[model samples]
Target: MTPDDDELTFGVEEEFFLVDAAGELVPRGPEVVDGTTERDGELQRELISSQVETATPVCRTSAALLDGLTSLRDDLARGAAARGLRLLASGTPVLPGSGHEITRKPRYHRMAEQFGAIARSSATCGCHVHVGVADRETAVRVSNHTRAWLPVLLAITANSPIDGGTVTGYRSWRHVLWSRWPSAGPPPMFVSLEHYENSVAAMLRSGAMMDRAMLYWDVRLSDKQPTLEFRIGDVAASAEEATLAAVLIRGLVRLALRDVAADRAPVSTPDEVLRANLWRAARDGLGGSCLHPESGELVPIWTVVDELVANLREPLGASGDLDFALDVLSRLRSTGGGADRQLAAYRRRERLTDVVDEQCV
Candidate 1:
């Protein structure tokens, strides 16, 4: 694609866990992924004996995304249901004392040894949104711009508010769990592709990452693709919610691209302010203030959200998903964001089973 390409494409990768009807975690049996042949006798990317992942083919527009994701999710659910398996989308382990067996593959085993104890204990699932970028400059701008919005995505999609089968008193405990890796936290602003590459090279040199793809920033250029990938969101409970996220990412990329075209800097803010708002968002979600990315002031999250929607109003309207985006916001507002729902489930039923059940539902 040329640098001026306006065509925005998308790919979604959802990591999931295989659960039972009784809402319990089942350790994936050995050769789980290898044995996961389709009923017709071929495996799509939906492999793993117990756990599985689904990737929608790269799509040209948001409308195509809805069709693709809905089809993939529905088919995967149907196939799993027929096999007496329940699929749950979340980050981190939800069942206490459940042993999450890592797939015994050379690559996975290598990752386990490379990341050490956290990798051994890590059972985190994330919803990665891949938005195609035309070049490195736009990719860098998108990465930096997307970094400031990371907390928003995290807050909204924080499905695993309770971690390790226990209430963590925060909405997205997976952030903390995911942060346990040495190089895994968030990213500083990368002003250019050279900067991002240098950081990744440094990480590799320091034994922090095996490769560039392991730079676990909220957003970054995919070493393997021509896209800026957002990896901050928890795997959502449903396809509708997942599409909402993808819509926002697509809009965000358009906005960033415009900013770069005009030589406009990202609405700048301090590192500490970003971190503070991030922690606050992790604790309270959309209900509290998100520090102004440029001002470092405690601004209401909804206020920021409204401003973002306004900035992308034209693109969002053009995509014809404005109504769906508004509906998603309404759901978050009325029923609560992920953290709110998780906490409420625990409070009403006094059990983590209720929380996990909500996850599978």
Candidate 2:
């Protein structure tokens, strides 16, 4: 990879739920989003009135990413507090509530009307990381190379272990819930850019997807930007965790770009195997086993994580993020990541409120 490739800009978009003091979701997304002023990013409304989303400015360094995320989160938290609600970063709500209201946007209204229950029930939160690429063709080719690593990333960032006041048993219950959408899940391996566009055309013609924006695959070429967006993981429970995910994703993308330049063929893991591993990652997180991306054998999750990090060592080091990435990984290993931390908090008093209380900060 060229020096320029190592400096590809990236940005992160995080979605959060607004909750009252009792740990119940509240329909205050518009109030919180409008009330907050972002210094280096943008805060906007999500599909549900109970959710708010943040998009950081294009960032060229890990430090900038951390600052943007911290600033935006603080703004949202303060705004939510002013309205007597808390900005929660968990992937799913911890306590059961009546239901969430759809946002007032015309598009959202149509989604609610057309998608019905699926749209109404999708009050989930997730972290989407966007990395700059040369063009749509590059994004499609890089996506092929990066497909195997998506599940490994999900295993690391699984934070939605509880939903509706009960332990849902899956580390990322949001992933399972998100799969209800007809166009959601891992993207099919494409042979070329034309192949990718044809697939999208077919999905639209078949009514599986309403538009390009509904391409809810784990990784997809952005419809609005010249970048590849990774939508695999749940929204991380903290800024550090989110930053770790971004740096790791950028490294993977950089490595993929190099492979593309060299004309190296992408790994051809079977589509069924990719979907199965995704489910396994969402279920276990970092606590149990996952299928190795290369060998397709069930192994300790950390083993797969280590192998991924090792594979990206060169790209990460080239980008001057190796030390920071290692430090974050070390902390995650010690604290057991977001899902583990939330589980620990709940087990302390067997109170789901504790999980909400701990993650909100």
Candidate 3:
């Protein structure tokens, strides 16, 4: 990929649940990942043995991102099949076993030791998008501005309606589960990069988390990279959906940076209100209402979604992702997103296995 001053690059990381031929969750992450290394560090183990994660290479455009994601999914599927398992991209496993097996990594063991049952119950998968920036200050500034829009992002990508063999009554049950962690959720606006770093350091000093990497806010500056990462989305049901989420997030970052450069103050929503907005989004998805950050009035989720896209229109067009964003948003509005489709499947067949199987394809 050639450099373009106007264009910012991004990457996607997706986590998947591994299941057997019978559509039962399988603790086979180690078995499947023991000798596999197509993307080396990009493909990694998660806390739970039933989960595997794959990261796309840095992509300069939406098309490149879609291509990389497609290849990664196919490669992972093929590898899992050879190991007598199937990879399901849904956020929560439909038939997760009651007992959990922790991966034998030191960090994972420590997490299990600390969080116990909560750690064991986390069989959720998600899509994390990282947008590259010029420097840490820019990343921090962009992240601060992006917080208000995160609920809309969650509503659009909600896919975890069912968990542990029962419907959780929340479109993004994964979000609900992850929120139990003290550090997870929308972060507070940072006054500066120093302030952000200091806040994380304080958390670390308090043993809230083992390290900076554990600061799992909905949007955060990357601890190890010069990028802003969005961790609000579930692992999308398809490669196209994943690509769409990544592009919109990159658009958000680009637009936020532009606002920052203009010396504009970011629109702020109080943390209490933001948390409530997140819960509403997770509960209803596009089927419900979302709080408009500006008005603080509840509006149709579709209206909020469209407004978000409109807000990023200029930046998206500048980054060559406007068309893709519009197309995906249109499709989502028309056919509904993963949670809608998953619920439809369950409603049609009245079976959780059917829902899981539908997502596997």
Model 2 agreement with the true structure over 70-176: per-residue lDDT tens digits = 99999899889988989888999889995489989999888888889999999899999999885788788899999988888998999999988889889999999
Quick one: best lDDT, which candidate?
2
* Model 1 clashing residue pairs (backbone): 32-49
Pairs of residues at least 3 apart in sequence or in different chains that clash in candidate 3: none
Give candidate 1's TM-score: 0.90
Count of clashes, each model: 1, 0, 0
Flag regions of model 1 displaced more than 4 Å.
1-6, 29-50
Q: In model 2, which runs have C-alpha deviations exceeding 4 angstroms?
A: 1-4
Residue-by-residue lDDT tens digits, candidate 1, 44-139? 332123456767788777667777777766656566666676667767556676646666567666778777777777776778899888587768
Top TM-score model: 2
TM-score versus the correct structure, for each prediction:
0.90, 0.98, 0.96
List model 3 lDDT by residue over 1-361, tens digit each.
1122556889999999889887788888877766465642267888999888998888888888898888878878888988888889889988856425898899989988887788888888999999888588777778778899989999988999988788889999999999988789998999898998898888989878877778899988886777778999999999999998888888777777777888889888999999999999999998899899789999999998889888878878888888988888888888888999899999997887888788994
Pairing residues by index, what is the TM-score of model 2?
0.98
Model 2 global lDDT (CA atoms, 0 to 1): 0.90
lDDT (0 to 1) per candidate? 0.72, 0.90, 0.85
Give the distance in Å from residue 15's predicted Cα in candidate 1 to where it truly belongs.
1.3
